[model samples]
Target: METMRAQELHSFYGKSPVIQGVSFDLEPGEFLALLGRNGVGKTTLLKSLMGLTDGCTGGLVFGESNLLSLSTSQRAKLGIAYIPQGREIIPGFTVRENILMGTFARVDGRREIPEYLFEMFPILREFIGRKGGDLSGGQQQQLAIARALAMDPKILILDEPTEGIQPNIVKQIEEAIIRLNRERGLGIILVEQNVPFARRACDRFMVLDKGRVVVSGHSKDLTDSVVEKHLTF
Candidate 1:
């Protein structure tokens, strides 16, 4: 079975080590929700997984292959797609052009947008000719997700995907995420503060506090006490 494991992992930004001694394992098609309070290392941990950090120590393995040794682009080529918090769509590019950018990492170099992407987020299709910067926040978030899907990645990591979106669009994004995991069998690592959504959609959950994983278990095992202790401010 496919697996991604981090052993005693530490990630640094310049002289500052933001993530220390973090460890976890994600099997194929697993959805792991990463929960944490503000200033914790949740974002950095995701960056480390994608080799976006300044440097990292220890081991990161995906199946039989080692990932820490790979570069950011190399990691993306290995079927790991990261949709960052800021929805980094190119401002000057059209909506279609932004989504097509993800295909650059495809191992087979395929450029076609997956039909399911449009099915999942129809607004992207409707605004295909519009510039990405002109779209609303909800639409940009959807566009970001659609861009990542265009790569046909095996592991999808999203950071606060619904942070600022409207309620209706949040529901749509949530449904899309669940469908991707249930129907497509993609392993997902979601960094989110929405406990209700995380509990409902994830198979397992992990808590990061001050850089280390303080708690982790099946999503069902994540109770109110766990949230109050580690997740709540």
Candidate 2:
């Protein structure tokens, strides 16, 4: 695992700036939660890291590579897997195919789905032959996560993964995320709205108000006052 650093990062969609001068460091195997209200550029910051923005400037370094110079595919090959909001699994593809699709970005060029993925997401294993569109929303979210894990990434980035999920599945997903970070040692950057979960699961938390970090510290320092002031909408 390698450290990811962003210094004075700014991201734009066409000519409009959505993420303005944000900076942070994600140490190897560290879980960082991004907390904020809607449309505050949390997603944009994640996209910027993956080079999905139309344009960006500043320093983004993952390990020894300068991420700004890499294309989205290149970044994935570098072991950064992103599970965007809405659980964008290929609806037309079978669950197996969708998970295999992630292997295309693997540097090893091997397309085998790791057995551990099945162990982590048993539901996916049970529905391996089913079409992605047939599964419920929570199942699709699990599929999305399994697909990302198939890449064998060193860092996992997720956007509001538990949103709209069933309460039971949400607990499962949260436990899986914690296991991925603590047991598998996968560094994580999670954009989430659930304050209690964020406070409990993350090593550090960053509160983004308007495309910039307003408050940040160890998870232990995430006080009620901070949540009431910046997170309560």
Candidate 3:
């Protein structure tokens, strides 16, 4: 597969296991919602797939390559872009500078944001001169995603994008995700606690209960009871 797949992925922080035999496959152009409560291994699974975990076991394969042996940069080079929780934008750099940082994997080091990027995110053009720290929370979230998009990744992993954003901006972000999946053929793995948002944005979803996949199927198959049981505290 040209997209991400995990077979019995397991990881731990110290002796306590976080991801316990978790497995899923993301198809090209598919939007997969990863739903779980706090500390359920959602972020840990993402890190493992991106090779950020120090002691991951089992198989995390991306496009025929086992990612356990690869470095984070190497995984990024293979086109897995992660926009972590809290929108990790560089506070000191200009918006353009932050976006430019995504080009580290590029063979040609270009400082300029490609014109094509503006087509995906026109608001970025207006913020080029603004410092990343000065942007509104919503705008900073957009910048974080745009920065990841600049990597031109085959797969985009977004962690709780709507967690702290305004509702209007969340709508826009959702639209952008739809465009990426439908028009651009980009596979998206989104980690979100918002059930409605997840159902709207993803075609398929997997629910994690204490680091185990408890419910998984097409999003169309989900019900209120399922969400309440698996996701609610």
Tens-place lDDT per residue, model 2, 69-145, is 99999999999999999988999999999999999888888999899888888998899999999999999999999
What TM value does model 1 have?
0.98
Query: Which lDDT values do the candidates have, in the order given?
Result: 0.93, 0.94, 0.85
**What lDDT tens digits, residue by residue, belong to model 3 across residues 65-96?**
88887899988888889999888899899989
Ten residues in a row with the worst lDDT in model 3?
105-114
Candidate 1 residue runs with Cα over 4 Å from true position: none
- The sequence of per-residue lDDT tens digits that candidate 1 reaches over residues 29-52 is 999999999989999999999998
By TM-score, highest first, what's the ranking? 2, 1, 3
Better of 2 and 3 by lDDT: 2
TM-score of each: 0.98, 0.98, 0.94
- lDDT score, candidate 2: 0.94
For each of the candidates, the C-alpha root-mean-square deviation to the true structure, in angstroms, is 0.9, 0.8, 1.6
Off by over 4 Å in 3: 107-111
